[model samples]
Target: MQIPIINRSRHPLPAYQTEHAAGLDVHANLAEPVTLKPLQRALIPTGLFMAIPVGYEMQVRPRSGLAYKHGISIVNSPGTIDADYRGELKVLLVNLSETDFVVQDGERIAQLVVARHETIAWEPAEELSETARGAGGYGSTGMQ
Candidate 1:
């Protein structure tokens, strides 16, 4: 699956770290460092543009180490990049910890996973079938 991309940043292209890795690591492309105070969020640019295939989309996700270490996370988790978008890729980062965190140029901040998706058309129905868990909302299943 070869997707065309335009990378205008000084940082390297996002790549999978190991064999069978699902996501590629992406970095920040900034002229200067940005600081994020507690509960603050910013849109950090990646300086990357791509033409994703019609059947596929890019999913931006958080780095677990950053979230567990400095309490950093993506504001819109699993941010979706549609196939039609042709602009620079930006990441919405937030500081969930009490202390501030600095974002440096070319710092690995997120991961992008390319996945195949399906487009759905709603079928209007008058009634639906039932199941054992029907109408059971969040946490309705008891722990064993």
Candidate 2:
């Protein structure tokens, strides 16, 4: 599936790192390094714009290495870029550790996963059907 994309930054476009990879690694587009203090959050731009096909969305997710080593994570994990949005893509990053983290230009900070979504029309109903696990949530199932 080919999608229209505009790359305004000097860095290469996002690409899958390995064979059968589901997401493309996205980089930071910054003129200068940005530091995130402990527990601080910032919006890091990617300098990328794309026209996603209808019924599809771009999901922004965190890199496992960064999360494990630097305690960095996306503020909105699995951030969604709707198909109709045409603005530059920016990632909301947060430092979850006690130390500061520096974001460099062209740093691979996140992954972009293209996903297909369905739009459903709401049908008003009085009550939902019951099942064995109906209404059971949040550890309702005992942990083995």
Cα TM-score per model: 0.97, 0.96
lDDT of 2: 0.96
Model 2: ten consecutive residues of lowest lDDT: 135-144
User: Candidate 2 at residue 63, lDDT?
Assistant: 97
Please identify model 2 stretches exceeding 4 Å from their true place. none
Q: Model 1, residue 68: displacement in angstroms?
A: 0.9
lDDT of 1 by residue, 95-119 (tens): 9999999999999999999999999
lDDT of 2 by residue, 91-125 (tens): 99999999999999999999999999999999999
TM-score of 2: 0.96
Please report how far candidate 2 places residue 102 from its true position, in Å. Answer: 0.3
